[model samples]
Target: MATTVRRTVLTLPAATVGPPNPLPALRPLDETHSLDERARQGLPRDMARQIGYEPLRTLLPVRVLDGYGRERTPTRLDAIVIENERLRATVLPGLGGRIHSLHHKPAGRELLYRNPVFQPADFALNGAWFSGGIEWNIGATGHTTLSCAPLHAALVPAPDGGEMVRLWEWERLRDLPFQVDLWLPADSDFLHVGVRIRNPHERPAPVYWWSNIAVEEHESTRVIAPADEAWHFGYERSLRRVPVPDFQGADRTYPLRSEYPADYFYDVPAEARKWIASLDEGGRGLVQTSTDILRGRKLFLWGSGRGGRRWQDWLTEPGTTGYAEIQAGLARTQLEHIRLDGGEEFSWLESYGALAADAATVHGDDWSAARAEVGSRLSEALPRAAVDAAYEAWRPYADAEPAETLATGSGWGALEVLREGHKLPGTPFDESTLGEEQAPWRELLRTGVFPEPRRVTPPGPSLVAPHWRDMLETAPADPLAEYHLGVAQWHAGDLAQAVRSWERGLELAPSRWPLLRCLAVADQQGGNAERAAERYAEAFDDLCEERRDDGDSWTAATVALGREAIAALLAVRRTAEARDVWSRLRPSVLERGRFRLIDAQLLLAEGRAAEARAVFDAGFEVADLREGAEILGEVWSALTDEPLPDAYDYRMRPQS
Candidate 1:
C-alpha cells in the first residue's frame, strides 16, 4: 500500500463560478403579529420598563440576508469564492459576512455545515438568528443580537501571504468596534481568523465574544478538547458542574448518541492549548484553534430523540439535519462578563482547518500533527512550536475556578443519563413550555451589581400614554401593549389608570403574575399599603409555585418577579413575609451570588450594620461576587462611619 501525498498552492478569487442558489422567502412578522412570546402571556411591568416602555423591534428589516423572514425585495448578491489549489471556500459578504462553504479538495468534503437555504429562527438574544456556518458573536452574549445582520466585508492582502477577507462591524449596543480577518494561504489547509475588539467610549463597557461554529452531527462524530471539567449552564445562565468528555461517569464522546439534549461549557486546563476538533468516522473533520485570550469551549446537542427532532424543526427548516455547536469564548464563560477599560482594545487569533487522522480521539498534541498532515509545507512555514510557545507565554489575567459544581446536571434531562452511559428518554420543550426567556441578570440584580430602579415619580411631561394606547388599539390582545400603557400611566401619575391598564393585561393572561407584581407597585405608590403587600405576597407565592414545579431558579423573569414582590414587602414593612421569600431562595442565592446582596439588605433593614458589612466582605472574596462587594461597599460606607477598604474602591482580584 502506498501513502497518498497531497500538495497545492494558493489561488486567486475566481471571477466566474457556478450559478447561485435561489433565495427562499420566509413570512415576516407584522404589526398584528409579534415575535415576543411574553406579549401573549401578559407582559410584566418591570420587563416593560427594562425595555424602555417602548415597542420592541423583534425581527430584522426585510431585504437583508437573502430577504428571508421579512417582506423585502430580494437583491441579487454575489458569493465571493476564495480558492487555493487544495482548498476552496465561499463567503457571503452581504449576509453577516460568514463563510458559506469550506471544501477540502482532496477528499471533496464540506468542512462546515452549509445550509442550503437561508432561514432565520427566533433563537438569539435578538429574536432572529440563522443556522449554519460560523456566526461571530461579539458584545452581549448568547448568539449575538447581530447574528442575522449584515456586516461590512472586504478583501485585503494578508501582510504575510495570500488574500484575507475582513469583516468589520460597529456594535451599537455596547458601543464597541469589532473586526474579524480571515486568511487562507495557498500552501496551508487552515483558515486563520484574527479578531480585534475595541471599546472606544469614554466609559468602561462589558465585553463578550464567542465564535459559534456549526458542523453536521454524525453518528460516529466525536469532539476532542483538552479539558478536565465542564461548566454547564441552561437557558437561564445557571452554571452546572459536570465532567467534560465524561458525563455521568460515562465518557460521552461527540456526535453524542444520547437521545437527551445537552449543552456544556468546558473550562480547559490552565496550561492546555486552546483547540477543539470534531472527528468523523474516518477520523477526518474540522478543527478550531485559538490563543488563550479565547479560553472557553462549549458543546451543544439537539439530541436524537423524537423531542430532539421537533426541536430541530422548531429551530431550522424541515429538511435541515441536526448539528452541533462547538463554540469558543473570550472569557471564563459567556455568563462571566468581563470589563474592558474605556478606549482599550483587545485582539486574538483563531484558526479553522480540515485534517485527517487515523486515531479515534484527537488530543492537544494531535493538533500539531493535524496541521502538519493538512499541509506539511504550510506547517513548516508557520512553525507550530514557535506559535504554541508564544501563546504559552502571555496569559490574560482572569479569575477562574476548578469545575465549580454550580448545578447538578444539564438542564435538558435526568442525571441518570450521565451515569448510565446512555441518553435518557424525554421530549424537547416547545416555546409555550419554555416560559419567559430573559437575559441572565438575576445575579446582577440580586447582588446589587445593577442598581434597583428608583421609586416611581409623578409621570413627567414626556409621558407616552397616547403612544401605548394607540399600540393597544392596534394590538388589542397584545399584553405588552397593555402593560406599557399602564407603565406610561403610572409615570404620568394616573395611579387609577395605571392600575386599570395592568389589571386589563392580567385579565387577558391571568398566568402573568408579573402583572400582579407591577400592580402592587402601582398600589404602593398610590397609597394602598395593605393592598400592595397582599398583591406582593400573592406574586411571590405564584412565582414559588412555578419554580417549585419546574425545579429551577435560573429564570430571570421569575427572579425579577420575586425580587419585586420582596422589595414591595420590605417597603410595606412585611418583614416576616420578605424573610420567608428569602429563606426559600437562600440556597440558590448563596450559590448564585445575587441573593447575598438581598441578605445584606435584610440585615441592614434590621439595624445589623456589622452583619451586613460581613456579608459584603465575604462575598467580595469570591471572584464572581466581586461586583456585588463593590456595590455593598458603597452602601456600607454611606451608612456607617467606617469606610470599606481601598480594595473595594477599585476592581482587584484577591491574590489567589
Candidate 2:
C-alpha cells in the first residue's frame, strides 16, 4: 500500500470547449401542449411507431418531482472542474453531474470524450439519453431513468485533503439513495471515485448501477479487458463464450466490421478484477477499474457500417462521430444478481485515469503490464489510514436528505446554495424495519426469459441450461430461475422438460401468475391448445384470487398479468373467459393509457370493431397523446385489412 500523503484539493472552472450543437434527434420536444395533444398531432412525417403500445410515461413510475422532459439548457449552465497537478476533470453539475471531460496534462489528451453540445436522444426508457462522458445509471434499466435529467451534486471536504465533487439522488421508484464522490488526488494521475448506495426504504427493492463511460470511437479504438475468455451474444442472439481477442477466427476490435453486429458480453471470471479501457489507436485512452461492487464490465459497439454511422449521427452532432460505452456494474454480470437488504449501505471504490500502452496487444489478464505502463506509482493502493479517513468523512452525506434548495433543482444547483452557508435537512436512516433478505426472484425477473430470436432458435437451453442449473444449485427454490429453466427448455423443443420446470416453479409459488402464463404459452406453442386453455384459465383464476381485493395496491404487473390471461384465453377462443378477466381489471385498464390499448384489443377480438375504433378515438383525451395515438394506430391496423396511414407503416420507422 502506498503511504498516505494528504494534499489540498482545488476546484476550478470548466476548461472544455463550447456547448456543442445539439443533434435533431437529441433535441427536446416542443411541449407547448400535453403529450396527449402532441401525440394526436402525430409524429413528424419521418417518424413511425411499431405494433405495440408506446408507454404513456416514457419511463414507468419515475418520480416526476416537477414535470417530464424538463431539461436545462447546457450552454447556460456552469461547470465545475476538479484537478490535481497531474490531471484535470470537468464535471458538469447540470449534466447528471457527470465527469464531462478528463484531461491528462502530460499527454495533453482528453481522457474522456467531451461532447461539443449537450445532446439527448430518445434512447432511454425515460425518453431522453445523452452521449459522451460518464453517466451514472442507477435504480432502473436503460440508463438510470434520469440520464439526461439533472441530479443533486455538491462539493465534499475530503479528509485526505483533496476537494471532492459529490452527486446524490433519491430514486423514488425504488426508495433508494445513491451518492458518488469523485476526486483527482494531488500528484496522482488516477481519478478516485467512492460510491454509496443506500436502501432507505423499509422493504428491500431491486436496484442496479452502471457507470457508462464513453470515449472517442475511431478505427484505432480497441476495447481491452483482463480476461482471456469472453462471452458474447451475437446478432443471432446466441450467447457464445469465446476467446477474448479472437472469437471464432475473427478479431472483435472496436469500430469492428465483423458480422457480430453489437457486443454485450460479460461472462467474466469470478475472481477477476474487472477493468475495461476504450483505447485510442495510439495506445492511450480512458481506463476504469473498480472493486467487487462493480463486477460486470461491458463494451457496446455501434458497428462500422452505414447503420452504425446513422446511430452515431443520432447521438452526436454533424461531423462529430458517435462513441461506444465501456460500462462497469456492481453485479455478477449485469443487473439483478445481487440485492440490497433494507437499510443496507453498499459502498465501493473505483479508480479512473489515463493509460498509454507500449503495444495495442492489451488483451489477457495482464493488468500488471498496463498498470506498470501508467506509472507504477498510480496503481499503488492507498494507505489504509487515508482510505479509512476519506470513507468516514464522506459517509454522512450519503444519508443527507435533499432540501428544497432550488425547488426541484438537479445537479449542483442546490449544493451551490449550500456552499453559501445554507444547510440542507437530512433525516437519519433508521434500521429498525430493515429486512435481512432482498426481493426473491429479482434477478430472474430483471433478466427476463431467453432472448427471442427472429428466425431459427440458437442451440436452445442445452447450450445455456448448465448456467440455469448452476443458478438452481445456488438457490434451490428460486421461482424465477425455475421459470427461466422452463423457457430454456421450451426453446430447445423439449416440451416435457419445460413442463416439469414450470411445474416446479408453480410448486414453489403456487400463486405466481407469470409462471402459469408462461406454462400456458409453452403449451400453446407446443400444439397442445386444450392444455394451454386449461393453464390459461388457471392463471386467470390465480391472478383474480391474488388481487381479489379491489383495494389491493395496483401496479403495472397486475395490469400486465390481467392482459396476459385475457390474451391467452382468447388465443384458445375462450372469449367468455377473456371477457371475465377484463371485467375484473377494467378499472386498472382504464387508468393507464397503455393498458387501455389492450382493452381495445379485447373489444376487437369480441368483434366490436366500431367500439374499438371509438376507444382509439378517445385517445385525444389521453395525457400522452403521441404514444396513445401510436397504440391507436396499431389497434386500428388489426381491426381492418386497410393499409396504415403513410406515417404508421412499419417500413417507414427509424431504427433506434
Candidate 3:
C-alpha cells in the first residue's frame, strides 16, 4: 500500500480547555529545576552554559489557561492520520500537534501510549496540558505554552514522493518559527518525523526542543539507552550524575521500580547513536531514534508510589495502564537551552517504530549487553546512515508549498509575519489566519492608531514582542492601548513604567477590571500585599457588576478573578471580606477543586479548622495541581496532627 495522509475525527470524553485568563501573567517565571553549586560541580562547559541561560522572565504574549475544569463531555477532536503499509500515525494538530497514536499493523500493536481521554490538566507553561502520546515540547524548560493550543497543519510533498502533514507555528516565547513534518515511506515500519526550528530574528535566540514520547509502563518494562551515566533530576530540585540502569538501590530503567517521579537524562557519548527504547517482558515495544543533532535522550518515570499512581489516575481514567516518557532534545538536559544564531536554523530527523529482540538478552542483568542488543536491532531496522540520508532528502522539500490546509493555529504568527514581512517560504502564516484577536493589532500596524472598542468589555490578547510593544508605545493613548502597553512594559521588565501605564488606564477606564487586576499584580510583586488585596477586591467587584449576563467567558473571568481576590483578602486576615468575595462566586465556580482548596484555606484562616478538615474529607482533587506543589501536605498538617491521605499525597520529592 502507498503511504497516505488524511483527515479524521477522534471522539473522546474531554474537558473543555476553556478561554484564557483575562489578566496578563505578571508573576515571575516558575522555575521548576534548580541545581546547587555542588550539584553542578562536574558539569561540562556547554551544559553549564546552557543551564539558566536566557530563561523567560514571564509568560507574556500568552495568557494563562486555567478556565478548564474536571467535568468532561464527549468531544470530537480534529486529527490528521499518516499511514504506510506497516504503520499508522495519528496526529492531533489542535493539541500541540501531538501524535495521538502510532500503530504497528504488522504486529497489531500500538507503538505509543494512546490516551483514551482528552483531559486538560494545568501542566503546561501556560497551563492546560494532557498526557500520553508524543508531544512536541518547545519554548522553555517546561511543556510548551501551545500544549492545549493548536498548530497550523497542512499537506505538503514528502521526501519519499508521498504526502506529509506539516505542523508549523510561531513560538512566541523566544520569537522563533518552527515546523514538524511527519511522513511515512511506503513499505517502512517506522514513522519518520522531521523538525526544523528557524530563528528569523536578527539576534541570537535560546532554543529548547524536546520530543516527548510516552509509552505504556508495565512491571517488566525497561527503558534502554546507549549511555552508562545519566544526570538524575528529581522533584527535590537537585541534579546529580549517576550510573544508569542501576541507580540508587534498584534498576532505574524500570519505571515501576522507582518511588517518585524523576528524570534521567542519559549522557550518551558523542559518537553513540541517540536512541531510547521502552520494551515489555517479551522485548516487544517502541523505540525512538533521531539524527545526531537531537543529542539528548531521557527517561521520565512516574514510579510505583502512591503519589505516582495517583498522578497516573489523574491524567487519565482510573484503572488504565500508566506510562513513562522517553524524550529526545537538542541539549544534554531539558534544563539547558542551546543557542540558535540569527538567520540560522536547526533541523533533525527522528524515527519511531516497534522493536522485538531476544527477551532474555533485553531483560538481562548486563545492562551493556541489553543496550547493545537493542542497538543492533535498531540498526538492522533503520540505520543511522539511513536517518541522515532521510534528513538530507527532506531538507529540500522543507521549503515546498503546502498543497492543502487542514487546520489553523493562532493568528500571532500571521501578525508577526505581517509586521516584519517575513518571507517564510514553506510555513506561511497567511493573513487569512488572523482573526478577531489580531484585528486591533493588525489595524494598528496598518494605521498609526490602536483602535479602542466602543463597548466596555474584557480586553483582547496582548502582544509583548519588541515590534508590537514599540507600535503600542507610539499608538494613540486609549484605555485598551494603555492596558496592552502596560502588559508589554511589564513583560520587558519595566516595572515602574508598567505600573504607571496601568494606573493611567485605570484613570481613563475606572470600571476596567483587567487594568485593576494588572495593578493588583504589580502591587503583589512590589510586596504591597494589602494594597494588592484592596485592588483585587475592587477588581472582582467591578467585574461582577459589569458582567451581569453570566456568560461562559465572563463567568470564567469572574471565577478566576474572584479566586485571586479571596486569596488576597485571606492573606491579610480579612476573613469577612474574603467570605464576601467567596459568596459572590457562582455555585459552579465554588464547587471546583481549586476553589474548594481555596475554601479550605479560607476556613483555616477564619479559625474553623474543623470545617477546613471537612473540606478535605469530602475529597476533591485539584485537577491542575502543580508538578511539585506541597500545598496539600501543608494544609493537612495545619488542620490536624494526622498523616496526609494517600489520595492527596502528590509530593514528588521525599519529605525531610
Candidate 4:
C-alpha cells in the first residue's frame, strides 16, 4: 500500500491540562545538573562553552502548567496517522506532536513503548508531561515546555510523492520557529522524520533539540551504541566519563542494572554512524538513526530500584511494563545548547524502524562485537548513505507550504508573525488564529499605550521578549503597564529596575496581587525571605478577597499563589500563618495531591508528626511530583524509623 496520512481519535484516560499559572516565572532556571570542577575537567571545549552559554534565566513568555490534577477521565485526543504497507505511526498533534505509537506490520509488533494511558506528570520544564512513544524535546535542558501543549498541524508534500504531516510552532522560550515533518516512504519499514529549527531574528539564538524515543525495557533488554565511553550523569548532579557497557561493577547497557535513574550520553566518534537501539533477549526492537548533523545519542534509564519502579507506575497505569529512552540530539549532552546564527536554520532527518539481529551476538560478552552486529543489521536495513540521501531529498520539501490545515495551535505564533512580519515560508502562523489571549497585546501593538482592563481581574500573560519589552518601556505607565513592564525587566535580568517597576505599580494600585506576587519573587530571589513571605501573604489575601466570585481562572491563581504563600510562611517557621493560608484554599484545591503533600508538611511544621504520618499512611500521590525530587522520602524518614514504602519511594538518587 502507498503511504497515506489521515485524522483519527485516540481515547485514553487523560487528565485535563488545566489553566496556566497567573504568576510570571521569575525564579532562576533549574540548574540541577550543574557540574562540579572535577566532573568538568576533561570535557571538550565546545561542550563546556555551550553548557554555560546563554542558559535561560527563567521561563518567561511561557507560563507554568501546574494546574492539572490526578483525576484522569476518558479523553479523546486528536491524532494524525501516517501509514505505509510495512508500518503505521500515530501522532498526537495536540500533545507536542508526540508519536504515540509505531507498529511494524511484518513483525506484528510495536516498535515503540505505546503508553496505555495519558497521565500528566510534573516532568516537563513548565509541567504536565506524559510518558512513552517519541517526544520532540526542544527549548532547553529538560523536557519542552510544550510537552502537553498544542502545535499547528497541517498536511504537506512528502519527498516520496506521498502526503506528510507537518507539526510547526513558534517556540516562545527562545524566540525560534521550528517544524517537524513526518512521512513514510512506500514499501519501507522505517518512518522518516525531518526537523528544522529556524532563527528568524537578527541576533544569534541558543538552540536545543532532542528526539526522545521510549522503547520497552525488560530484564534482558540491552541498549547498543557505537561508542566505547559515555558521559554518565546520575541524579546526584554529577557527570563523569565512564567505560561503556561495564560501569560501576555492572553492565550499564542493560537499563535495569542500575539502581537509580541516570543518563549515559554515548561519546559517538565523529567518524562513526549515529544510531542507538534497545533490543530484548530475542534481539528484536526499535532502532533510531539520523543524518550526521543530529549527532548525540543517549540512554536514559529508570532502573530496577523501588523508586524507579514507583515512578514508572506513576507515569503510566500499574502492571504495565516500564521503558527506557533512546534519545538523539544536536549536542553531545542535553546540558549543552548549540548556537544558531542570525537568519540561519538547523535541519536534519531521523528514521525509526524495527531491527532484528542474532540474539547471542547482541547479548554477547564482547561489547564491540555486540555493537558491530547491531550496526551491520542496521546497515542492511537502512544504510547511512540512504539516510543522508533522504535528508538531502527532504531539504527541498521542508520549504514546501502546507496543503491543508489539520489542527490549530496557540495564537502566540500568529501574534509574533503579525508583530514582526516574519516571512516563514513553510510554516505560516495565520492571523485568523489569534484569539482573546492575544487581543490585549494586539491592541498594544496597534496603539502605543498598554490598555488597562476595566475590571479588577488578574493581569493577563506578560510578554518578555526584547521587542515587547521595548514597546512596554515606551507605553504609558499605568498600573497594568507597570506590572507587565516589571515582568519584562525581570526577564531581561534587570532586577533593580524590575523591582522599581513593581513598586511603582504597587504605589499606583496598592491592592494589585499580581504586582505583590512579582515583588515577592524578587524579594525571595534577593534572599529577603521574611519580606518575601510577607508579600506572598499579602498577595494571597488580596487575591482571595478580589476573586470571591471564584471563577476558574481566578481560583487557579488563588491556589497557585496560596501554595507559594504557605511555603514561604513555613520557611520562616510561621506554622500558624501557613495553616491560615492553607485554610483559605478552596476545598477542591485542598483535595489535590499536591495540596495534600503540603498539608503533611504543614502538619509536621506544627509539631504534629503523628498527624503528618497519618497523612502518608492514608496514601496520596503527589500527582505533580517532580522527577528526582526526594521530598516524600525525606518526610518519611523524619516521621518514622522505617524503610520508605515502595509506593512512596520515588527518589532517583542514592541515599546519603
- Top candidate on lDDT is 4
Provide TM-scores for the models. 0.50, 0.53, 0.98, 0.98
Residue ranges of candidate 3 with Cα displaced over 4 Å: 28-31, 34-42
TM-score of 3: 0.98
Ranking by lDDT: 4, 3, 2, 1
CA shift of 604, model 4, Å: 1.8
Clash count of each predicted structure: 7, 11, 0, 0
* lDDT (Cα, tens digit) per residue for candidate 1, span 1-656: 11111112223221111111111011122321122334323333432232232232222111112112221233344455667766777766555666777888877889887765554544555345667888888755455656655555554445343445566655643545566766666565666677777665557776778888888887777776666677654333234567656566545555456555556767676676677777777777887777777888877765565445544544444676677878898765554446788867677777777856665324323443533343343244344563454233221201111111111111111111121223111111112221111111121223323222233111111113233244333444445445555655554446687678778888775345556776876676578888988887887676566543322222434444555567777887787788777777645444444466677777777778889878767754221222112454556665676755543432211211
* RMSD over all Cα atoms, model 2: 16.9
lDDT digits (tens) for residues 195-251 of candidate 4: 999999999999999999999999999999999999999988887789999998999
What's the best-to-worst order under TM-score? 4, 3, 2, 1
Q: Predicted candidate 1: what Cα RMSD to the true structure?
A: 21.8
Residues 62-167 of candidate 2 have per-residue lDDT tens digits of: 4211111212244455566677777777766555667778888888888776777655554554444567888887755455556655555555555355456666
Deviation from native of the Cα of residue 157 in model 3, angstroms? 1.0
In model 4, where do residues sit more than 4 Å from their true spots? 28-31, 36-39
Q: Ten residues in a row with the worst lDDT in model 3?
A: 28-37
Model 1 error, position 643 (Å):
60
Clashes of 4: 0
lDDT of each: 0.53, 0.54, 0.89, 0.91
lDDT of 2: 0.54
